[model samples]
Target chain A: MQSTITGKAYVLGDNIDTDQIIPAQYLTFNPAVPEEYQMFGKFALSSVPASQAGLPKGHVPFHTKDEFVSDYRIIVGGKNFGCGSSREHAPIALDAAGIEAVVAEFYARIFFRNAVNGGYLVPFESVNRLCDRICTGDDVKIDVENNLLHNLTTGEQWQLKPLGEVAPIIDAGGVFPYAKKVGMLKV
Target chain B: MPAMTMTEKILGRHAGRDSVQPGDNIWVDADILMTHDVCGPGTIGVFHQHFGKNAKVWDREKVVIIPDHYIFTADAMANRNVDTLRKFVAEQNIKYFYDVGTPRYKGVCHIALPEEGHTRPGEVLFGTDSHTCTAGAFGEFATGIGNTDAGFVMGTGKLWVKVPPTMRFVFHGNLPPYLMAKDLILAVIGDIGCDGATYKAMEFDGDGVYALNIEERMTLCNMVIEAGGKNGVIAPDQVTLDYVNARNASGKKYDVVTTDQGATFCYERVYDVTKLEPVIAKPHSPDNRAYVSEVRGTKLDRAYIGSCTGGKMTDFRAAAGILKGRSVKIDTFVVPATSEIAAGLKSEKLNGQSLEDVFLSAGAKIGQPSCAACLGGPSDTFGRLNGPISCISTTNRNFPGRMGHKEAKVFLASPLTVAASALTGVIADPRDCLQ
Candidate 1:
């Protein structure tokens, strides 16, 4: 895992569920297949309502038409981010779409587990709500080592809650590798 | 030693520990790991990826595969997903593979699990679907997991879990005729916002809870995930024992555990069921709740009764009672959660006519037993809200685009409410149509 992640941030409102992150319609594309996995990026967040797609300003697409990857590398979200469904595809979709980190006030349990266990993205809980402060398409830097989110576009910074116990797992890249590292699984 | 709640007890026993508490991450063995068509292929891919292409599962009998979601569709990929499950089950020689197009085929994984006796008391069950918490009704620690965790469990028969502190929700008094478990859970969710129980266990207790039948108890546990609950549990008693004993095909022994006396709870709530009225979760969110009377006469384009949450024998019977003599004023869809429930719709009668007859006479379109249009699978999925419209449904969720079109609105209600609203072409109170 990189200590610093710098990218354009995409802002979204609260309760951005799995359905909106990657609609059920696109779930048929198997993530295990490299081609189908890449297809997830094309339709990621396609079901988020147009008005709620991008915060502050609306109707902003997470990715350009037919593209598999997004220009944004980080996501800024409100409370209850990833609140619905146990679909691991939600995190896989975000990862496939080029998102490296998601900073939210809090997250639904299953989504948080999937994001970390799957090693798809770094799910950071901000000390305070950052969705209102971060604009979509703003340049942001996440200093994971220092637990700080620097909004380069706005020249403001905020503290992120420490990753705590799960940091080692994330650093090892998902549960499987972590298990092997901790001697839970025989290498 | 500190007293442990039912969830803590189950997790501790599975972890081979005498004591476990909230926030303590421990490795626990899984009694059953369920995977359905939607996530099965992905899980299999992961299992094979890390464990080796030819490596065998830790225990073939412990893995149960059910192909339910996106079934009965012509979509090539959807069909192929089930094929993947079939091939893996054959190669692994798993004991509990309910394949599509076979007599053993079940409709929805959550409902089918209890029916097949896989959901036993004092067992830990992990499934790839969020609603797997439904099995907690049988005094167990059951929760949803992602494919990666499930794959790990598949390979090792164990996975790490953080014990969740239990929140006790004791329901007092009998539920009024107009009220169902759906209404009770909706009330709880409304009181505490969606994320209120984000990582906690919700333990349902008191007279009002046990009074409900097994299916209704399952309904109560089913939506705990909606509030971000890790699991929902009710202490197993005669009602649970009777159901489990009758259905335990393997005759597997399971310990019936309960919250110890004076157990600590992080939070507690009490609800008088008799005081509760018919409630509905309005569009976009499950916690956005309203009394049916508050939304009376709200126009609806469709009425659907189905899914693990609503499509059970009890749900269909309640819906049938309201639809027996009346015809629907709007598009109405009735889907049983499993094939057994579908057969019940035919053999089970309402006033001498079968439940299926009641639904058909009421102008409801009956789809094959599956999760048809609950999560809005394919464009061709039956009962899917393809157009922007308002619907009253017995489904668990009302998230945006949950049913079909991104702009479509879904109001989550009980089967009785959905049937009543179907007759009126609007969101009408079930009490108005109940007799």
Candidate 2:
């Protein structure tokens, strides 16, 4: 099974964390806040709008209440996604963001498992030049079946693979669904 | 008659086939299973769904439950997990219950198991947490399981696992006075990279293993997953057997498991701890090993000194001794591993110095038994843009934003190192602060 999403290509530095994905203070509040308002609540993302976009102001963080929330199917980063605590919230926050896949140079074990278990297809992929080419909301086409993520805007494709023994689960729409069927059976 | 490595011997017993070889895939029935609140509730939920009702447990006594993760209850969900396990414990009639607000609060499952005498050497144990392998420090066969496998164990007290290849880490030299097991493991992580031991059984042997206390050994095994090990263990020798004698003073039935020499280690990694200084994993990555001296000047917003990894009576005593004469800088939290440790810290005297009194006098906010900042399940938020921060902690992992914010740096250090950093309010080598 494969899918694709076209949107702006956003670039973040290494060590992007759950706290940055969704700050703890904002997580305590109702997740119903509009999406833009919820982003980087503890710290704002520079000139990103807070009022019009309704993005979180003053570190409020990853507001889920978003209408035009771009379906982020691909993420490219330096190293270590979900490397910190086994929060499970990191994947949850990404799932809520409509992220279908994350591609990183590397990953922390717990995060990798949590991502697969949550039905988020996070592949370990790195490209030399893709970092500078993609921008926020650039409409990328991720060829999941072939393990290729195409930056639609830049005509660039990257490589990645689902972790060992975890690929099938993500294809099945998360652990809950996978557990309901395949995982129940003894291999 | 030939000798086998400790891992090979253990695997040979459970090999269940002709000549159980290293990396041989085999399924061994688990002897014990433990879970904490953070992952416990998830396991229970999944277990209830599959069983639709409580299934027959292979051994009720062998299964244990501890609500150590979300001790203070960050939110309703955390509280709900505690209640979920509590109800099941009562319904299943499981007697080994370590509750909150007790000296037996059981900080982390691994720390609690050995201290409470729940696990014996040589038996394969499964925990619903990555650090569960800490039990291996006592020479017990232990490994961490996901929620599904954990749920399977909760219902049946058994689960499946491939017999992992043996990776022996032989430390032969005398460690420096300041350096300990954590440093050795960190240095190993530095060499092997984080994923060095994936799908392998790490057996720590040699005189170095003999020198470390169970607490120190637990520290070594605690971060095994940081290296992607299927599990990590040590041979049960006198140090291990004696520990069981003291801990299981109840005279409960005991089972012993050990590996023999000639047992091939698929890979052997050795370390010399003689010149080891307190190592810290820079924030956002447990494998980000750096000498404390290299990152010493890193300023910290919050200094935390507790977790299953760091929160022990011994660790607290060490921290307190380091801070005996000095007061903690503003914004430092010294959380005990568990309530019992907290209570014990009150009377624990490190080198003739009363730590509980010393720390209390220094106004260190003593936290209850729970996985405080290490797992980031709760507050004590540290170094941030409001102010650049670096936290030196006794807990495991320093991944970005682990302490408070992503940018907020955290350094994984020994308890003594964390204590010194707490006093200085910056990452500091304990050599200067310790007497």
Candidate 3:
């Protein structure tokens, strides 16, 4: 795992559930097949409206895109991010779409575990006001070891909760590799 | 030593420790593990890849495999997922593999888990499906996990877990006849919002909770995940013990655990069930709840009753009690949760007519036991939202495009509320329709 990650932020609001991240319809493909697994990246956030014409009168925070943009590597989200189903595909899709880290005020417990165990992305929890300070396409630097995130665009800094026991698992590249390193796997 | 909650006690036992506190990270042995067709194939693949192709499972008998979702779909890819589960179950020599089209096959994994006796008090259970928390009604510490974590549990029978802080919910007074456990839970989720209980164990108990039957308790625990809770637990009582004793096939003695009187909780809430009204979660989110009266007369194109959360016999009975001799004004689909539930609908009767007969005579389409139209099946699925149709569903979620079409709107209610809405062609309060 990188001690510090620098990337552009893709901001999302509260309660961005697994369904919004990747719907159940897109989960029919067999994960054993690499070709099918590769399709998850394209389907990430496919539910977000591509244009505001049909959108009902409400606060719509996501970008208008049918496909995930590879440019944004950090997701800055409000409270309870990844709040629905226990589909690891949400994080898998995000990882495949080149999201290196997620900074949220809070995360659904299962998504947090999935992110850590999958070792595909880093889940950094910041203060509730962190999302208010950051915006889309802003350059952000996450110093994981120091428990801090710096927004270069606004010159604002946010404190991050240290990853404690979860840090080594993420560093070992997911649970399977960590298990192997700690001699949990016999083979 | 500090007093322990039920979740702490269960996890401590599984972790082989004298006691455990909130935020303690420990590796615990799972008492029962589950996987369904949707996530089973991926989990099986991961298990094989990491544990070596020829390695056997840690304990084939301890793992439960059920092909529930995507079983009845015409889509070849969906069918292939079940075929993969069938092949893996046969090869692994699993004892509790429920394959579709078999006499022993049950419908939804969550319902089947308890019905088949995989859940017990004072045990630690995990499943790939998020609603796996439903088994917490049996006084167990149960939660959902991803495919990879499930795969690890399959191979090793153990996984690492962090103890979560406990939140206590106490319900007092008598529950009104018109409202069901679904309404009570919806109110809880609404009060807490979606993220209020994140990473916390929600312990539901009180005089009102003790009054509910096992099935209704299941409904309450099933939606704890909707509020970002790690698990929902109710202490096992005579009602739970009776249900378990009647269903369990292994004859294993259960260690029932309860929270100490002085147990610490991060949060505490109280509700008077008598004062609660029938509630519905409006479109786009389960926590977007409103009173049934608030949305009354809102037009709906269809009404659906089925899913692991709401498709049990008790739910159907409540719906039948309201829909007797009345024909639906809109498209209505009635689905039983399992084959046993389907049989119960056929055998049980109201006014000398079987519940199934009443539904069929009332212009309701009775579908198979699989999770039909709940998770948004293939295009050919019955009762699937095709266009901009508005629906009142008994399913757990009403997320955008969750049932079928992205443009379709969904309102979630109890079986009685759904039946009432079906008769009026709009969202109607069950209390208004009841005699």
What is the i-RMS of every prediction?
A: 0.8, 6.3, 1.3
Which of the numbered candidates is closest to the native, going by highest TM-score?
1
Second chain TM-score, each model: 0.99, 0.91, 0.99
Q: Taking the tens digit of each residue's C-alpha lDDT, what string does model 1 give over B333-408?
A: 9999999999999999888999999999888999999999999998999999999999999999989899989899
lDDT string for model 2 (B219-299, tens) is 888878777776788777777788888877246765566665456677886766675677878755677888988988777
Where's the lowest-lDDT run of ten residues in candidate 1 chain A? A58-67
**Candidate 3: regions farther than 4 A off:** A49-69
In model 2, the Cα lDDT at residue A94 comes to 58
Quote each prediction's TM-score: 0.99, 0.80, 0.95
Q: Write the per-residue lDDT of candidate 3 for residues B1-435, one digit (tens) a residue.
A: 679999999998899997899999888999888998888988898899888888788898889998887777778888888889888888989999888888989989999998998889998889998999999999999999998899899999999999999999999977888999999999999999888788999999899999999999999999999998999999999999999988885876789999998999999999999998999999888999999999898999999999988899999999998899999999999989899999999999898999999999999999999888887867777678878789999999877778877778999899989999999998999988885
Pairs that clash in candidate 3:
none
Could you give candidate 2's per-residue lDDT for residues A4-75 as a string of tens digits?
544434444444544445444333332222342234232322222222121112222223345324334455
- What lDDT tens digits, residue by residue, belong to model 1 across residues A1-187? 9989999999999989999999898889888888899988888899999999788898998887449999999999998999889999999999999999999999999999999999999999999999999999899999999999999988999999999989999999999999999999983
Q: Rank the candidates by TM-score, best first.
A: 1, 3, 2
